[model samples]
Target: MLTRLLACTIAFAAPLAALAQTPPQVSPAVEASAPLEARIGELAQILAGKGDYDAYFAPAFRSQIPKEKFAQINAQIAATAGPMIRIESITPRTPWVADVTIGFRDAIGTVRISVAATEPHQVDGLLFSGLTPRVADMGSVRAAIAALPGRTGFALARLADGAPQMLLADHGDTPLAIGSAFKLVILAELVRAVNAGERRWGDMVTLDGGPLPGGQYMNVPAGTKVTLRELAQKMISISDNSATDILLKHLGRDRVEAMLAVVGIADPKGMTPFPGTLEIFKLKGVPGLADRYLALDPAGRRQFLDGEVARTPIAAISPTLFRDGKPVRIEQLEWFATPTDLIRVMDWLRRNSAAGPGAEVRAILGLNPGIPQPAAAKWKWAGYKGGSEPGVMHMTLLLEGKDGSWYALSSSWNNPAAPVEDVRFAGLVGRAAELAAPQP
Candidate 1:
């Protein structure tokens, strides 16, 4: 499952979402002469690390995503999703746009691609979301996640009149570290503020400070004007830390903390003194700061983040803190939430995103439906948010089942002693999500 280049498909104008988003699955169906269908073979070669980049893509596609960057995205997919095996299906939306199901050694995946109508028929764009493991039902998915090392949790719930009817769960009440997934709270706060008339989606704010890694906003000049909608859109769609921190600051840190209870965090005190993105880097960068901060009660940590940690120079925060590609105080330093807690959070967003500037909330979440085709087709409407760190992995979704009922799936995996494999975790989560049955 590949997720970074999704926004690049068609006319890639917006900042892309996360780099590791994966989508859904389905049966085999091949069209012999659908125009764009012929290009699928070339895509297979490219994804398998053997295709010709210059010949398979148009200037427009090549210009936005350099050959090297394109290759890297494919390498990342192979690293996680395993090597490509074959094509399962190609369902064309148009001669230009189509959803193609692909088989990988570890999982089955669906990808969206757009091709040029003229000439050699080069690729215009492509979006890779996620992968679903070859499984018979949710039971197998739950078992696999349970067998994983360290802390792991999964929940399948049906939303009935604003409440969760637990359909299946494993460690559903245990809170685990959720990396960028914390942006959901920030989004909920933004919606609440807009609904209260405190701010408008059109409100523009000068981007504060420097951009951090893992985001396009990292390269954007500080102080560049950006709108609430743009920031929020980038935040969830790509889990942009820079956008998240700016929105967190603009909304007021304390207000966001207060929103925990409003959004059903279970234990609001667990996340009190919520730290912004920069604050997190500083906490990890400073020698022994994480252990000290973790040792303190929520109130004390808040004070440190507001005072000593707040004043820490940006230069002191080294990107090297995470360079080793290993967990760095994840348990003591990341956003905490349980499986059921996430269900409530998604429910809040689902019920409230129907009107006003808040109306755009749904679109933002669905900008990249972390799951693709056959599995994706299970829901009439779908939205996803996930987070990852060295030892922490999370995939959470808000889905409207085909019966017009709503459902939420929250899955998490954390290893305190080592790193968790991305592709394996994605396959497990994707299966449970695909098996979502609302009425039961």
Candidate 2:
């Protein structure tokens, strides 16, 4: 639960498309004047793999974004999305600003362009601001998720003041290995503490011990002072394990565990004496330790963690344990949660984060939204935290959809024999978000 993000959502990483994708038969309908038409044609050419990058775009724009780079991005998107199939709409905001909705075989996006007034009207500002997969219906969303390898659990629910209303779910109640997504609980406890006036967000924490060094912190010194705000942000946004451990230690294990009920975890005792990332690493990384720890009751396990696990030097752990690139004692050693638990935790976050000290929680979760644009844009706010390790992957989203409709989608995929496919899972959540949201 304490590791940094293993993989970012693919949409935010880069444009994606499939070779199997083929252009659909449809014609463009240009409601605006010729300026948009010309811009759309050039953009289509790029996606269609026929554009001369240097001659078409403005000199200033090309200077910043090289022809080869743009060409490659277009090629990748085209390869997956196929050629531009249709123009959904074109709206002019000003003489120079306009939005163009372009559709591809499997995806659709709105690119906003800024055109220059001079001859050739060589476009100046161009960006595919948001792109979302085109799912025919909820069946496509479910099928995409079910097609993945290993055990999978997913839940999509509408959240508004009361308990979450499930829209669609597959194996939503089953408990599975949820990696860093467990950080949500840690964040929730921190929010609770800050809200109750037990602690202040601006409190300074000095680094007595940090799992890894980031070349040092805050430009002051190695173990320098950092704010709770900074730690909370890093812990959630980047899933920073070091920050997580620090906050967990600062918050007290019992205090943090107490909030588990507040967040609606069904079996709080299952995760009793919650272990930090370093603790989990030591339990699994140290030879002959997992079995020893697994044999104990919660009290015995907590004692073992504080005693032998804490005393063992980091050097004593075998590097090869993690080097094999396979799941290592994941089912027995890692953090645990169910899809419903994740949604409930997220719902608590959404409801509490509306004001007070919890407000920053919203911004922190939105820091690395995990959702790509257009789909991300559909929601007023998109807060996300994803987790992964060999044989384990999880994604949790808190979305504020149109008309003040709020929702959460959480999923977990675990396969001990091999690495779970993260990109496919990312696409599943993306399509689910598109389907969950009220269409424009």
Candidate 3:
């Protein structure tokens, strides 16, 4: 066993002696001072001395990035990581090399990165062996949008592209009353009736009374015969409540309610064509009213007045004394609705592709364009309806940004106890609408 071990050792010694006999030459000064170029030399060694270059370079990409992404980053680093990069740090104090660091900007954003690499001898520079860029964040844009007061209440949803979009919301899924905005529904029903051979677009309807005060119904003269199409246009574009009521009567409240129900709206107040109980009160001869208020049942009437229906309360005194000698008062009725309901009605119009400009709610709201364009440039469509009774002043609007994004806005002022100018509330509505409108 000893003889065998000796023979094996002698064989190893022979190979060692041959290698020593032809020792390679190296500069003494280069060997002595190479530590100064530590960071640069380490990188040079990696590029030139490593047998498996990938094995040495692979760790630089120790990230969850996809292979393609890694390759892209690698290419970008190779092209931009010049001597501006330097050895930022290193673990064990390497005798011959410093650490590596890099800084660069690309299509994405700027990046300042550090890694342990060797120092460059050619130009007193550091060679980067590892490189990476900083990731960009979009939180600022989201914060800016959220911070905007007018934007705070909007509910966000993702678009097809995974981009955030918004919708005006009021808690649950209640249908908006839209006041005369409901005229679009009337218009839609009229068109449907015409299409179904039930009526003609040019069919004439006679008005038995003059327009109500502050109502669009006054636009046409009493006893004047007008085509259905004419009434619809006036009712919708001008938000004529009288025209709306008249049209609603013609279309039948039941039909409208049924249509709304089909669209997933559960609010009976919103789905109802008119407050049936409230309509019944007007029929009871209380004064300051019309026959339209008689459409509701007692329970429905009570339900309508519940706090959930509207933020504003019914007026103590009625706005009018009679509707064609039919007595009525707002206080006698129990139903209430808010401007938010009005906007929801507009949404329904758009979703159902009902009548209005382009038969879509977006076209009616005129907000999709963010700014009011010229009539020739799409008219900045908008859905607007205003309501007033004694101290009650209310308006609801749905505006669309130029990109078809929408905003629902409602404003109401109930100061029956202290009486405010109706015009003031109207001005507020306009202002809120303007504020809610999207801008480029």
Candidate 4:
């Protein structure tokens, strides 16, 4: 047994003897060992070739790289990896450990990167892009608004992490009437007309006595030659009824409706002729009669009810004026909108303001471009247009504050049958603006 064991040992020793006896093969090229950093760089290239971009060296190599230079190195890795080396994360695992996780888009799939050192200077993490933090919370804006007595919807958006982000909303996609805010469509069309050479800003419309009081047309002086631009200004800024009617007449209701359709406002029927404009005037002509029968004072509302007229026409008109939130003469006046729909109009107007010359929609009625905002501590700049037809009161505003943030507010009360004296109707919109506008 001993001899057999000896024989086995001899067999194993014979190969060692041959290895010692044989001369070692030598190559013509001889390279010295490189520093750790140089070795890490070499390893990075190898891993990059192997579809492991996160395979960067940890420890001593990581200590050599500055934080600012890391981005450049990461970019270089991506370039070398041909789109497969998606960087996930690069972070320290421990004082002595560095980890890199690499992601490959191709067949090789994913790999984790880990490098450790006895001392400092190590990078350890998964290397890839898309690692920014995001918080998806929109409840705050809603909670703030829900405190109010009425229902209103809103939308908010801002830049976050290099992209447009929607931060708040409630039924924000639904469309509504948007009232005089539709005038912005007229402004846009006028700009288009100027661009097409069909009309110029200086083009004039002669105001005639036939269009005014009886208050059927706006109360402009007879023979007033207002420019198209001036008409647009008054129409939007002060919500002037006469200026709007002239522009509406000159531009044609059908053309304006078509342009509104292009901007995606639903049901562009407000511009069309309706009996309400004339009916309201007829009703306004009646005086003490309307007040006596309606049980109201008649001193202030010269446009609504004349104080001197007899009672017979007042009795005849009161039912028609106060019916079911819907006036008998003009059904379209019953048209009102949602808050979200108003945002769309404001966004459209902002886009219009950003357009180039001949495309500018200049303000005519409200605050001019450079006008200072109101001085009220709570109220800043309130550039707005208001529409009131009985139970319906609509307001659109571009509100800015001391904080330099701007909010576009669109609000309408649909209770045309509800009393305007309810005050809450207007207060609803005011409350919305108060909540939305930034504090002084």
TM-score of each: 0.81, 0.72, 0.42, 0.46
User: Which candidate leads the pack in lDDT?
Assistant: 1
Tell me model 2's lDDT, rounded to 2 decimals: 0.72
For 194-238, candidate 1 gives per-residue lDDT tens digits of 888998989999866543433556566777898999988888877
Over 1-440, each residue of candidate 2 has an lDDT whose tens digit, in order, gives 11212122111222221101111223354244476567766777766657777667889988656777677657545644667888887767555556677888877766667677777877887765445567777788787677777788989999987899988789998888888888888899989988888878899998775343121231234567889999888777666666777788888888888989999898886578798776777777678888899999999998998888888766555656544457787778877889999999999998888898888888788876665455676777778887877778788999987678788999888888886644456655766776678754
Query: In model 4, how large is the Cα lDDT of residue 124?
Result: 47
The candidate maximizing TM-score is 1
Which residue pairs collide in model 2, if any? 17-80, 17-81, 18-79, 18-80
Per-residue CA lDDT of candidate 4, range 165-247, in tens?
34455655534333445566666677767767799888888887443212124444688787888777655544454566577
How much lDDT does candidate 3 score? 0.37
lDDT at position 366, candidate 4? 35
Across 345-369, the per-residue lDDT of candidate 3 in tens digits comes to 4454454444433343333333222
Better of 3 and 4 by TM-score: 4
Which parts of model 3 have CA positions greater than 4 angstroms off? Answer: 1-185, 191-200, 206-224, 239-242, 262-265, 270-335, 338-340, 354-379, 415-421
Best-to-worst TM-score order? 1, 2, 4, 3
**Any idea how many clashes model 2 has?**
4
